[model samples]
Target: MQLADLRRYGASHTIIQSLRDIGIKDIYPPQLEALRLGLLSTKDSFVIASPTASGKTLIAEMAILKTIFEEVGKVIYLVPLRALAGEKYADFSRKYKPLGIKVGVATGDYDSRDPYLAAYNVIISTNEKMDSLLRHSSPWIHDITLVVADEIHLITDAHRGPTLEVVLARLRQTNPNIRVVALSATIRNVHDIARWLNARVLESTWRPVPLKEGIYFDKSILFDDGSHKEVEVATIYDPINIALSVLDEGGQALIFVNTRKSTESVAAQAAKEVGKRISDGERKVLEQASEEVLKALAEPTRICRRLGELVKYGVAFHHAGIHSRQRKIVEDFFRENRIKLLVATTTLAMGLNLPSRRVIIRDWWRYQPGYGMGPIPVMEIKQMGGRAGRPGYDDHGEAVLIAKSRRDQAFLFEKYVGGEPEQVISKLGTESALRSHILACVATFLAKSEGEILDFISYTFFAIHKDPTDILSIVREVLRFLIEEGMIKEEGGNLKATPFGTRVAQLYIDPLSAVIIRDALFKAEERDRDLTPFSFFHAISATPDMMVLRLRKRDYEKLTPHIVARKDEFLLPLPGEEDQEFLAQVKTALVFLEWIEETPEDKIVGGYHIGPGDMRALVELGEWLLYSSYEIGRVFKLRRAVKYLSPVRKRLAYGVKEELLELVALQGIGRVRGRNLFNAGYRTIRDLKKADIEALTKVPTIGKEMAKDIKRQVT
Candidate 1:
């Protein structure tokens, strides 16, 4: 495939002209052929599975630009992360906006009107936002003529894969002629995906910049292409040794560490080493850049701090913990060669445009539940390796793994560096996600009847040619719940979204929100005014506010010192000299702190602490809870319930209160426990004076001493 061939095969002159304008006159022969013949013939959905840092995104952009120039219909560019969507939106907007193309972004953090959605030629969004837009029946959605599922390989992720699959299936069915462009790092099941979508597969192993794979064993570099050499790890300055070598050769580097802390640690170390090598003037320039970067990193969030630290050192880190703006700065800096090195997490591998001449993997195994310190899948590691080369800067890029032992070195060489990626599987049938989306579909009027809804669902990848025996039963039960709640009414042959349904739709909540709200309402009605509004709100927000596990400090001895220091500084009174109450609260918060530190390195969920994913789920739950309560309040005119709940709703919107610290410090109290205690005649420390000691003990397993201690602590 060649650029000339694409011209001969009827590619729009505009696309060719744009490529030329970007100084890309010579398209790699294979990619050019794929665009000219392979993509042009496709009528079904297809994925371009290729190496990381390949021109897969360019292919997607070409398809999208073609669709935009051909008609007024909208193009939906779906990415996995909010940051990526924002980055892509800016990229596309800068290029196309001046050319009269309007690009809009709808990510998780922002919500705008549907009218604006229609006005934009391209809308870049996260999958969740896209799902929300669809559920809200955004008028512009139907105007979509093209959908690009970037990072399409995520269809295999358990938590989000089902949502992506359902959305894609729904979009394709709604507009049979809509062009679908699915881009992914090389996956094992390109054929399976192609067969499912009935679209042509343009699979490539070609790299615009060559990537060389090697293992560091016994201080030796062992190359994979039947070429072997020894690189002593001990004699090597650090992972930055290879990075400095690349830069000295006039190329940049992207070093991936498994954690944010490691990212910062490595960047600091690399900057010191790289600093010693540069001229005084160059060092000053780096130091100036580093100062700006440090300011951003100090912003409290993990990503900002990491990037900030890296920028100060003329290096930066990329991860989810940092805010989006800081991540963008790092990306822009790297893209323009302002920053020479980036110590990042696996997030850097996910379709971001920054490429480097060297990629060093600090750790290959991450901890996960049921398997501690397990090997990363070959596919993911490959994606990181694929980012090793820069198209214009380097003829070859080096990917190095630091191996502690020969066995480890062998594992890296044979299993990760030399292996194919795993097959992509469908997540359509997962109960947790499926149940929510199914209810969402009913609420949105996409599923109108038991039979019609069933048929519509059958079109999903989950039900495609699979036995629906259990699925049918599940859908029936959900529909019955809808009817019982008066959310839907069967009229003639169609099921209609009643007033309640409309409210849920308007609020953009998950069905699980309805479930939680119904439970809360039942409890409220059983014992009127017994349930504190904040308790319900907390329940809804807890999942989303779950913190990442903090990494264990090197000195467990320092833990107590830090706790004592914090209490002294804050002037927090303790129950006794031992300060058990304060200690307990510190421990609880530490649990969350530790969880945040470990989450990136350990794929542990529900690991004794809550994290961002859990927090997101909770936020959605809270929104749904409020929406449901509002609807019920409207129906029965329960003004009091609505009034009492409003403040709690406001609290949830803003965030958990600092008073939650006092609540967390109470003995035998978790989030739920604190909520229950506060609701049960114990709203404040003074209220404990009014309670019967024995009776308080009897309240959910508290004993006499525990009750006395709680009271004493509160006082």
Candidate 2:
């Protein structure tokens, strides 16, 4: 079917014209099959099971534009990650704004008081942000007409699955007639998901660029289709060798490694190989990308320097360790074909619109802290493979797994190449996920009674797949715990969220996080002792949201003594039940305390064995939890801790000590500027207000324009 034919399925002329303008005159075969299956035409929901880059997004675009054109209502396009949300918002806004569509993105900040998205025709958000909005009972959600769940298969994800499942269930309950659209990659038992959403199933294995799967051994790749190709190999791991071969063929390659360290190592190695082959023009392009990398980092962090050095050879690495903007720059460079190779971690597997002619799986086994090393899931392997074959650029793509031995080669082929992707499983009934959602439901008055709460939960994917008895039992247990913790209370035989419960939900923090904060505050206030930042850091690190750093044996031995020495300074006694987990939390808190003390990032990484990604993650989660802890402290009347925590939270956020908190609040200011101003006799807003623009500009890290901006802010 032609793209113009979508008009018959209720796509407006503007939509069709937009499609044509982008050279999408003909609909891809898989999307055509879905259209024939009444994906956009029908009022019912749809679960589109297809490969990545197979026009799933276009199908969703058609639906979103069609629904908005009909004046049906506002549309919600849900993506799994903030990056995907930003990408979708940009794409939709760019293409459809001219066609009279108003698109808005909501992520990171969930200010319930501001329904800024109400004016938008289409709203793009992450699953968690959407869930938070729903919990806040945002007035705009009820107006939602079309709901698109991109990466619907994430329902199998244990950490994220419950929120998606419960959010969908709530939307279904609130707006029963709302149209749902789920776009997914190939997964086993697609019909089960279809059954959960009450949507028609459109299954297509067709790829816009046909993929060739193979196993690489001893410089030769044995294709699954019984074809063979000899490739050069001079390194121990031949991902770089395979990538060099792909570059020789005039196509880009994506090398998937298991760790960030491997990504940098492989990119550096690949750059060395490709450097010799780079042309002058290509060298110029690489230089531009390198400049952008440095510009993204003011002081050129270690990761930035490494990335900039590698990109000079038309090769780069991407992982969470790199800043988001820097990563986006790398992606843009790769998209323009200036970069020949992108070495990445499992982060690439999650819905990024990056495609290449060749994908090399450098590691098939992943190391988990508790489980040692385990083979990668078949679905993960498939997701990485799906990155191959840019539709317009490559006629065909290749996905190959590397093996060192024949026995290992056979196992790789049997387990990943020949294996079927796993089916989605519901995790809605997990104790913590269940508790958080249940509190949200009660706090927002979505479910007033136990029966109503049960009914609400009954609509989840967990209830659809399993017996109700188990879920009901878990819900009751969670309710009892919440009541015991003073988050909720039972009155007149109906469960009601207390003021504390409502605050917890409004803060978008886990109920268990509040519990830990309350316990820590109570213990601290119970006695009259000094409360240190390390004490509170330890408290927040043990919360569900904070990622605990792993403590090596030598590190643990070093920290164990410090922790023991500082035992009196901690608010609550450390948990004695789980020694290892407690020690890890202590290690995490120590690192955080060091961070707030203005420790150098590279020094922290070297001493604590934490990555840039982990530091970024730690700061973000720690700041939020600190705010939550402060609010909870205020609620419980821990006056001393509350006063101490307020300034400390600001310090944690701006990466400054308490003295710079007053200056960091100004516009065009951050840690570096905040410190500079403080060191330059501008310790507070009053000092800044009294200073002249010349004095401000004389301060280190502050220029004329920035000084004027600071003056304006202070005055």
Q: lDDT of each structure?
A: 0.64, 0.84
lDDT assessment of candidate 1: 0.64
lDDT (tens digit, per residue) of candidate 1 on 24-125: 566664457456554543444567888876677777777776777755568999988876887788888888776678889987621333666778888998
lDDT of candidate model 2 versus the reference: 0.84
The 10-residue segment with the lowest total lDDT in model 1: 596-605
The superposed Cα distance between candidate 2 and the true structure at residue 398, in angstroms, equals 0.5
In model 1, which runs have C-alpha deviations exceeding 4 angstroms? 1-5, 18-24, 38-45, 109-113, 228-248, 294-310, 369-372, 463-465, 468-470, 473-509, 521-537, 542-638, 644-715
Given candidate 2, what's the lDDT at residue 680? Answer: 79
For model 1, state the Cα shift of residue 479 in Å: 4.9
Residue 636 error for model 2, in Å?
2.4
Instruction: Write down the TM-score of every candidate.
Output: 0.75, 0.96
User: Candidate 2, after superposition: displacement of residue 389 in Å?
Assistant: 1.3
